[model samples]
Target chain A: MSVTSASPSHDRPHWLALDRLGVLITLILLSSFLLPFALFRANRILLGDGLPLLASMQPVAASVLLLALAFGVGAALLRLPALIKLAAGFGVLTILFIAMGLSAETLMPADNNYARVSPAAGFWVLVFGLALLVTDALTRLRLGPWTRIGILLGVCGAFWALLWSGLWNELSILKEYANRAPAFWNEARTHLLLAFGSVAIAAIVGIPLGILCYRVRPVRAALLNILNIVQTIPSIALFGLLIAPLAWVAANVPGAKASGISGIGVAPAVVALFAYSLLPIVSNTVVGLLGVSAPAVDAARGMGMTWLQRLVQVELPLAFPVILTGIRIVLVQNIGLTTIAALIGGGGFGVFVFQGIGQTAMDLVLLGAVPTVVLAFAAAVVLDAFVELTSRGGRRA
Target chain B: MKPGLLLRVFALALLIVLLVAPQAFRDFFALFVRPTQPPIYTQGNLLDITLSHLMIVAIAIGLSTMVAVSLAILVTRPFGAEFLPLSRAIANVGQTFPPVAVLALAVPMLGFGTAPTLVALFLYGLLPIFENTLTGLTTLPEDVMEASRGVGMTGWQRLTQVELPLALPIILAGIRLSTVIALATATIGSTVAARTLGEVIIAGLTTGNTAFVLQGGLIVGVLAVLIYDSLSALEKWLARRTGRLTRADA
Candidate 1:
């Protein structure tokens, strides 16, 4: 829009450049001692030591080569193409991953299985900094949501494929994954079960409660207040609170154990998750129902439609889109929250997280954290697409 | 008279009751737990822990609001419009990156203390405030903005006076959401050795002490309710003052 205002060269902003001196400086400074480029350990005792990128010749070469290209492009006094920037970012990421993998391969003793070779906080900082630069360039291109999602999936798929092909087998995180390969699928299954079960329960309970809250006058405050109160209780605290009562039920109630309702497992995890999921679903449902136009309801009523028929035929369809959006939020939120389920001995991906914490192993933590992030991201995207499709249909109607 | 005042009075009474519950019901909770241990959270002083929790939340939310609001303002400007997607992506990263993961990542760099927790909380609180501020500023009436500009008000003056003031209610709603989230999420800070209410729950989890867990949950839940109510009241007041509320009463 402001492109037409270019009377003087000074008034016009410069276009993109490859090195972007600022980005180059940032990358170098970030990869240097300002952040630990790599972590080292002798045996299982993780030493609080990090080596700069130049600590190893191969990595240093990689860094130098990358920086040289960046500097050459930047110093050429020519604006870089958007496509080139994207490709360069992709290349740099591949190089960074390979550099880390190569360093790990060389650093760890081949004979010793217990020795750990991991990237420290600095490595992560550099990765993030580079990622920010790449995303900035990508955003400047103004890609659509589907295109962005495709880029994400493509990058992730390639990385996973490389990992599966044994390219990153020597990396400490993959090693952690290697050890838990059998259990990983099971934990993933449990994680999904925890997420989906709670979402299902929340929807079943919340939709009706939402309708009731919308219809009733006095019930709204009391019901919403309770749900809000429940929501505000921290996830860990909520899980802790459920332990006693569920324990009591398991001990005293006949057939409770038979039904798999217990104090410290999926039962309490799902229950706490269900509680957490309710506020969004219920509030969204009420909001959606209330959002229906008055004239539509009036017309239905004038047509001699019963109250139930009016609700079933008119209100639900109008409200379905908003309700789906709420469910999307709940699903994504629950996916992340379910990681806490492992803290209570409820089987899920959080098992790796807590175990990693216990062992003070960052790699093990990634073993859990990465999958959870992916699951949550995927659920949010899929549900969002669903919401868009339905809402568009609603708008058309 | 006013319903807002009535709600505040009710909330205040409820708050007082909740704060006193642990001390008042120590003996009652002892029935649920074994007779050997104390029934209530007596490890770290409950009041002190609560104060620390509040302080941590306050500082984190304060920092996040400043950054988020500034970014929101920047993105809405003509110069920074290309950055709207960039800012949104950054905020999404903050939201979608699990706070626990952030804490775990932060721990190695900042070590085990409040610093890591603060980092995690700051990131977690960014999105809601940013989104709300953007929504508020961008949705201001074109006529109002034009009038301000026609009056020769500078960019800064228009922002500080016309834009922000009118957008206060919506911005406050966002801040309210952020604050509530920060309050609840702050409990996880204790896992990293931050002195928050989560310490009570974590201790209970470790030792199978249900009474300790209950005390922690009760205090946090009550605190959340009181803060939420007060913020909602503040938002309503802002809305009313700005003439945003057409319906007189609920």
Candidate 2:
């Protein structure tokens, strides 16, 4: 963990040599094999009857061994610290992966086809990979022309991988013991996608309102108040509330269904998530717009610009940072709430939460909630980078 | 009075348009509030929306103002300059955290009640208030602060007598923010099964009943706009009053 720190310790403890590029190579090699197995189960496997991860766990186990051996040999032959670090990292990560694969957990107590290997193996692999990646990225960090942007991108990439790939993968993971893990993973993935979609929708609607409110007091007050009320509504209830309008539309509308063929997935999920994101966008937009300053406005107006022109040309550019901050909040919030969307068949991570609650399966709960938490954190970090980038852009302008 | 009344009318018109527009969703509207069912938007529902809206607004604004004011006090002192930006950023982050996350995290400890919703509302309302409080407090004439200190006023004395009076206008703006945020967030109480205005809106949305959704959403929107406009008016009034008082006292 210290290896990933921005300011590394001078006397780098050999145990946590973060800059050990050699370790990254090894870690990746071990992960390449293990992850394929897990990913295969997620994307390719058909969970019909009793099925182990493979007819024999021979491939992953063998690949892990081979990966570890290759890294160690490559490290010594080259006499390069980077190579050595990669080799060692790979060996350790592979051992971890193989050990986890061997101890795969049962996904469902009652079902047969719904079982698979434990997903924790992939999660740890991702973590190991990320640790190496972050460390390497940090070592290469330097002040230059695109330094801030580079740093921001690196941070965002790490965050995206952690959220979108790691914790998120756990929710819809592949299993060796059975397909239950994959089943659970699918439900979570659906939720994540929908939740992300919901946030996306919110951004579409809220950001504009936010910007509008900044320049127009009457409008801003109205929007802020509406969003404020929306913000106070609890998650479960919001989803519940969203049902009414959508149901009404679905049932009454001539040809339109609520979500699509499913008539449930996107419509209700998007509405609930959208309602939740309103405040962040509206609040942020108003603040960001206001931050554009009176003089900037005066100057623009003095330049004989129209109100619309001043807003688009001056206010929006200045207000971009604050707006990004809001968007970041909206994104993070949507990630968490998307979990609750499953209750309505909107599908996503909430399937695990609700299903686990019903079956009293803590493993299923972990399968669902863990990914959401990670995704939320990852989302937050990425949003922050975007916010900073926008802010810097604003400053430069 | 005339313009306020006119705005109120316009707001009501907007509400009616939204609510009645969902006659388009007639079939979906029945799930929550059946045609045979007693009207959900009776005096009780409106009153309910109003009451919940007020309670949340009160709590959020009350708590946020306290926090912002106290923090403003601490950070506006002689040695507190460097901490100002940092404190503001932390406040911003607090506001940035989704109210849903706050509610989710609060659920375990608070166990699905107004308590969690209240806490969420308060935290979510923190940023604007905190920033405005700092802006209002700090932007006062430097001479005023120095004059109070020069004339042998203690820190507390100067704060209560001079600084706070000057900052009150800006602080009111923060309070306005808290009120607006709290009003909307109170709707989230439905997640915990806390029967509030959100109950109506959520009920409407879940079943695809646009009327119920429209009805509930309309009520919320109207209530929010009215209350916020009032707070804003109050802020303007306070700013003017303090402006006069500051000049007269000078």
Candidate 3:
């Protein structure tokens, strides 16, 4: 690699120039050495004793982990290429995950049904630090968008492969998942339905309302103000607020109860999600349409295109990326808010979360939380890619 | 009267009525209650619960603002610029992780009660403040920055007198958003045994008492809106003072 003469490192030694990757690697080493790597619990809900790295795992695994750490330090201290640093980071991370699983297996007594082994603070710190290193290397490499997405998929596939190999089966979280495999899938479905269903509905209604708002100033002001007020209400309070009104409707409205329009279940939950979703959708739509180039619209008009034709053929196409951004925001927000819906009997992954909270079973809580986070993160990355692609395409067109 | 003043007065009046004599709404609440169920939350003093809830939110927001602002400031500095991408990635990813899940996860480490709730709120509230502050700090006009340097001002002086004053409006806006989110999220802290308004709603849910649910929901909802409005007003005033009102509105 060619070094720029203006860089401070030319005047000083490379080490003195402040290596950020080295700082992260040092942090990872410190955390791995200083903190407990695993928790050994006699039973699921009880407090566990902290276990240090070597004590928590088999000797072979511990040695491998140590070797990986050594390699990371070497990569950090040396002025290695970004590509090598990235490979080292990924290798260290994979070893960390495998070692974590091995640690759990080593800690648990095979015949003891109640024994639980969970990752501790050190493990998490190492994972976070290593992930940062990998991200830093990736940023330095400056991969294209498609390459980044490919890497994302590859990382996800690695996690799937690891799990499929039963490496983490001994871990408490996986154990908890095994116990409620069916319920986990059930809740996963419910979570998706609640989050996606509401966003879909919001788009259908919000897009038209947004167009109307763009057409009429007064309605725009009044409607946006109302939605702002709605948005200000917390998810829990809004869900609770909907209960009384919907319960009344279910009691009095002829077909409401039979149609599942009750206060305490899916109906109110979906309604609340839908309400929370409208502001983002409608506002983004308006903003997007407003952002369409005036020249483009004028050209369409000059071509004798009707208003609808101009809107459909020109404006909406230009605005789709921004509107999709709004939908992405809504989808992620709804996924999170859906967890709270479990409070009112709207079943989702939150069922596991709340159930775990009630039972003081943190593994169960992780079972719910981990998946929700993964789902939301996946949605964000995929949507971000789509937004980037469409925006690029729009500029080209 | 101006709509702003009218809203303030209405909010003040409602808060006073709710605290001074909640019984004023008892009859109305009773409409939703069964004969046997209580018409209002009787398990805890509503004012005390509300105050404790506000206190929790205040502490969490205060802590988050300090840390987030400092982190943002650090990352924007020349020496710390290397960390900017990492910090940005963290703030963005953290927001996607739900507040409720964060709250639940904290329980394992800190155990139940206000401590875990505070930790969760602090973490969840960090992103908005950090992101906004970073934007404010990084987006200052290049000419203005040059002007400050041309005056022979020290780094500290430039930050304090020039950068901070110009960025205050955006920072305040971030605080407003964070506080509003904290207020809402704090309600869920009750699930982990923190003393918040959610206790009332949870009680209501368990007993099928619509009145109790409505009482808690109304108070929390109204409180959030009022705080949100006041903070927004403050932000607007700051923006106008800094001659950035139009941009702030945008």
- Clash list (residue pairs), candidate 1: A36-A122
Judged by DockQ cut-offs, is candidate 3 incorrect, acceptable, medium or high?
medium
Q: Which portions of model 3 miss their true places by more than 4 Å?
A: A1-18, A77-79, B246-248
Separate DockQ for every predicted complex: 0.50, 0.11, 0.70
Q: What lDDT tens digits, residue by residue, belong to model 2 across residues A123-233?
A: 444444534533333333322324444544665565455445333232233332134656666776676677677667777887777767765789877777667666654
Top model number, lDDT: 3
Compare the candidates by TM-score and give the number of the best one: 3
**Candidate 2, B219: how far from true, in Å?**
4.4
Off by over 4 Å in 1: A1-34, A57-87, A133-152, A293-314, B1-23, B245-250
In terms of DockQ, the best-performing candidate is 3
Per-model TM-score on C-alpha atoms: 0.88, 0.56, 0.95
| lDDT tens readout by residue for model 1, B1-250 | 3986677677667556545555777677787689888788777777788889999999999999999899899889887775677678777656666767777767656767899888888888889889888888888889889999999999999999989888888887778888888887888888778898889888898899888888787777777877877787788888888866411122
DockQ of 2: 0.11
Clashes of each: 1, 70, 0
- The positional error of residue B162 in candidate 2, measured at the CA in angstroms, is 2.3
Sorted on DockQ, best first, the list reads 3, 1, 2
Worst 10 residues of 1 chain A by lDDT: A1-10
Q: By DockQ, is 2 or 3 better? A: 3
